[model samples]
Target: MKKVIVGNHAVSWGVQLARTEVISAYPITPQTQVVEQLSEMCASGELNARFIKVESEHSAMAACMGASAAGARAFTATSSQGLALMHELLHWAAGARHPIVMADINRSLGPGWNIWTEQTDSLAQRDTGWVQLYCETNQEVLDTTIMSFRLAEQVNLPVMLVLDAFYLSHTAEPVDIPDRELVDAFLPKRQARLKLDTAEPHSFNALVPPASYMEMRHALQEAMREARTAFDEVEEEWEQRFGRRYGAVEAYHTDDADLVLVTSGTVTSTARHVIDQRRAAGERVGLVKIKMFRPFPTETLRAALAGIARVAVLDRNLSPGRGGIFAEELRAALYDVPAEDRPQVYGYVLGLGGRDIRPDTIDTVIERTRAAAAPDREDLWVGLLGDDGAPATTGRAQTSADSLPGVEA
Candidate 1:
């Protein structure tokens, strides 16, 4: 049935349908509703599950790891700081090869304190060896939630799907809540390939000698490589039954285009409008929306941008001294492509801390990319304060009401 619901509820619905046996989470902005709804489901008997009200994000993840290792389907949810707290256990779950699924509502990290959207938190954990899938809409959130479980179990790696703070987490949209029978058929009971069996005691995560550590790490890497194709097959099976399919990377009209705009999360929606408007004006421009970040879709990206002359990567998250993380990865991914075939990729950072990413902001990125003499590795701030963090006297630095829509000085 199709009903209008916020992204958080969509996640809860997906979890319920997947028949998650264990859920452990601590409340944080935007992500609180997801756990709250799940708790209610558990209490009301609509969902048969164990809802663990853990003390902190770390404990929540630890509980999930334990439950998952005990041969149960486990899950959790969190935001910026909450996600940061779980960083330690994030590695544990991946290293143990536990198929735990988590929903991270992307929010800003701060000294000044803000609970708005930013991808920095999850991106910071890039080296943690977890599968990351970023969703662009509420519907995608629900569908991805269900599919993530299948993918995680298939590869024996934890999966984390991200949603923009308020744009996605708090907003409402129509979502097709999959029928119980369909979801059951799609994602049935998980029979652990390995588990904590009391009858057959075995050491898990025990001390490993230096000689054996490298081999274990290599095996995990091999699984990650296999996940790339496993993810494709999972989604293909989903499309066959559900009539909807979103690839690891999604391309919008890149065919024979000279310039392309790259984005993830909600920004992709706005970029699509910009692309449509530009196309009407007879411009050879396109948009590429990345859904799966980890198992980084190298070959998929190469094919989408193979012949393009220039590409603009707009990142809402930053790496401080380094440029946008996504841009850095793209540069490396395209490095081996023949020099003449690789496009000059520009990285633009914008819309941090829940600030809206309007179509005008995206337009500026494309304009700058077209004018730049060479690919800029340094991150360029798209919406900076009017000069010195005060009112701008003129030009693009103007921090006037018109300059910052819905922003109060």
Candidate 2:
């Protein structure tokens, strides 16, 4: 059914249709509405599931861990400090191989206690051993949530579905909610290939000697590598049923473009608009939207970026000393490609703390990147100011190791 719905509600419906057997969460804006809607659905008998009202985000995840360990498909949602609170459990969920899926509304971390959009909160947990997917729209949110479950369960890892807090979470848009019957056909009951079955009487979180610890870590790494294809196949089946296709990355207008822009979450939508407008004016520009963050889609990114003259990476999150988080990842992804196949890359840190990124700003980023294609230059930061009132540009070869705090490179 087609309806105007906010991103959070869209995700809520996705969870509903997925028939999640367990949900545990605490209220934290702008993510609070997601849990609220699910709570109402549970109370009204619209969703037949166990809704555990926990006192805090930490407890919420703890409850989810218990539920998932008990052989139920589990889920949760939070942002910023709430996500921070759930930190220890985040590692537990992934390490336990519980197949728990979560929705993290990307909000800025605060010194002044702010609740606004930023990518730092999610990026901070990059090493937590979870498969992360960043959504560009409400439709993507709905679709990715379903795909996340399939991927997580297949690899026995957790998945984090991330979207911009206010930009996509609160904003309403036209979304096609897939029929419940169709979703049921696609994702049936959560039958575990390797679940904590009390009947089987197995010990999870078992103590391991040093002899097996390294091998266990290696096994987890192998599973993550194998999950890429598993993720692709799940989406293929979903697209065949829903008439929409998604993957680790989605490229737009890149076939014949000289310049490309890469981003995640809601910024991809803004970048797409600018690409379309510029295409109308005869500019050869395109965009690449990264949906999967970890299990880093390295080869896919390299293939998409190959042959482009220049590429601009606009990240709403910072790596503190480094300019843009996504940009740094992109450079790493392209390391193995021949130097000529590599494009001149520009990095921009914008939209942090709910800062606005107008279409003109996107256009300016692309234009500047194309103009600054010096062979020796390695990195440039657009839309950020330097100490001397200049646009921020750093040598691409340097990794911001010596960067000072509050200073743009």
Candidate 3:
């Protein structure tokens, strides 16, 4: 069936179709609607699941861990500080090998006390040993939510599906909601390989001494590696059934282009429009959209951008004192490529705290990248304002949303 739904509801529908046995999540901006809808489904008997009401996000994740360990397919949703609060248990969930699926609405962290979109929250959890997938559209959000459960269960690792806050979480779009029967056929009830059993009570996550600690860590790494391949196989089957497929890294118009812009989340939509315009004008520009972050698609990225003259990465999140998270990772990934095949990487940090990344903003980035003789080690800041709230002099021309039709300021 086809329905018009917001991204949060898309997540709710996906969880419902997956037939998740347990749901636990505390209310947080942008993410609250996801759990709210699921709670309603549970109450109305639309979804036969246990909705655990927890006092905090930390407790919510704890409940999910327990439920998942007990052989139930569990799920949850959170954002920004809520995600930060679950930090400790995130490791426990991954270390204990619980296949819990979570939806993280990308929201900016507070200090300035703002409830807007940003990528820092999720990017900060990069070392927690969970698979992360970023989505661009409501349809992709729904599709990825179901696929995540299958991927997580197969590899025994947690999976997080991330979407932009207001851009996707609040905005409604037409989505093709798959039939429950079809979803059931794709993802049957999860059969845990090793689950807590009352009849055979066995302790899990016992104290690990140095004698065998490294090996356990190594095993986790191996599972992460396995997830990289498992995700591809999972997507292939999904495409065969639904006739839709989204790769970890999707390349567009890069066959003979000199520069390719790399982006993620909603920014990719704006970038695509600009790429189409540039291609029409014969500018030799292309684009690459990265959906999968964890189990970083290093090989796929290398193949897509190895011989390009220049590759610019637009990061919506930042790592203070360092630079853009994605940019730094991309540089490291491309570091070992032969000098001849290595593309000079230009990193630009923008859209932090929900600032609008307009078409003109991307246009400026392209012009600056093409003009630069050498890529800078540090990322350039776009759409920044000075003390007077005037656009800062960042070598980017000031442009408005009105410059392009169908683009809102």
Candidate 4:
């Protein structure tokens, strides 16, 4: 079925089609609609699932954990502080291998309490064992949500499908909703081999001695590695059924390109426009959109970026003193590539706290990359407020949404 729907509703639809048995989530801005729609579906019997309206996000995840342990396929959605609050249980879900698929509408963290999009919330949970997939469009959000359940259950690791707060979540777009029967065939009910079966009363998740702990960690690492390939297969099957697929990492127009821009989330859309503009005028520029963030796709990224002279990594989320999260990971992924064959990856942090990442801002970054020597991996906060709370640099106003270049206050 084709419908024009907001990203949150698309996610709700995906969860419904996946036949998630237990849907639990607490309301938070940008993510509330997802919970609301699910609740409505549950109440109206439109979805034959148990919708647990938890008091908080932490409890929401806890409910999912319990439900999944009881051999039910589980799911949830959250953003920003809600996700932050669920941090501890995020580990529990991944550690216990719950296969709980979550939709994190990326929102800015708050001390002053802003409710806009930012990747920091999800990026901060990198240490947790969840397989993270960032979506670039409403359609992708819907599709990734369904694929995530398959990926998560296959590896028994949680999967976080992320989208920008307003850009994807609030923004409505034409989406092709897959048929429930097709989805049922694609994602059958999760069969948890090690679920909490009452018949086989046995200890699960008990404290392990040091001798058993490291090996346990290794197992998770192994599963994550396996998940990378499993995810590919899942997408391949999805393509066969739906005729649309975005691989774990998508590269655009990289052949014979000297410069390639690396991006994730909705920034990829904006970056695509910039790349096209630059490419038309005889600029050898390309783009690599990272969809999967976990298990890092080190080799995949290395292969895509190989032979390119310069790669500019656009990080929408900062790790504060450490620099941009994606940039750090990319450099690490590309670290083993022989220096002569390696791309000099300049990491630029832009559009924190939901500030619009303008096409010109990306243009400025590209120009800066062209003019610069090898970056020391220092994060350049492009168009961010200076110490005096002013626009850092002014290059050109490329569009009406261009909040870059001479940003006023």
Each candidate's root-mean-square deviation in Å? 4.1, 3.8, 4.4, 4.1
Question: Best-fitting candidate, measured by lDDT?
Answer: 3
lDDT of each residue in 138-257, candidate 1, tens digit only? 999999999999999989999999999888898999999888999899999999988899987777899999999999899889989998999999999999888888899999989978
- lDDT tens digits by residue: candidate 2, 1-409: 8989999998899899899999999999999999999999999989999999999999999998888888789999999999998999888887788889999999999887889899999998988888889998899899998888888888888899999988889999999999889988888888876656767877888898999888878877887897877888998998899988767998999999999999898888888989999999998999999999988998888889998978888888877766678888988788778888888777777877876777876866665566553422334444455566654433223433334232233
Q: After superposition, how far is residue 160 of candidate 1 from its true place, in Å?
A: 0.3
Q: In model 2, what is the error at residue 330, expressed in angstroms?
A: 0.9
Quote the positional error of residue 38 for candidate 3 in Å.
0.5
Give me the candidate number with maximum TM-score: 3
lDDT of each: 0.89, 0.84, 0.92, 0.89
Clashing residue pairs, candidate 1? none
**Comparing 2 and 4 by TM-score, which wins?**
4
Clash count of each predicted structure: 0, 2, 0, 0
CA error at residue 327 for candidate 2, angstroms? 0.7
lDDT of 3 by residue, 1-409 (tens): 8999999999999999999999998999989999999999999999999999899999999999999999999999999999999999999999999999999999999989778899999999999999999999999999999999999999999999999999999999999999999999999999998899988898999999999999999999999999999999999999999989889999999999899999999999999999999999988999999999999999999999999999999999999987789999999999999999899998888988999999988997887788667676568777777556776534332232222222212
For each candidate, what TM-score against the reference?
0.95, 0.92, 0.96, 0.95
Judged by whole-model lDDT over C-alpha atoms, candidate 1 comes out at 0.89
Instruction: Give candidate 1's TM-score.
Output: 0.95
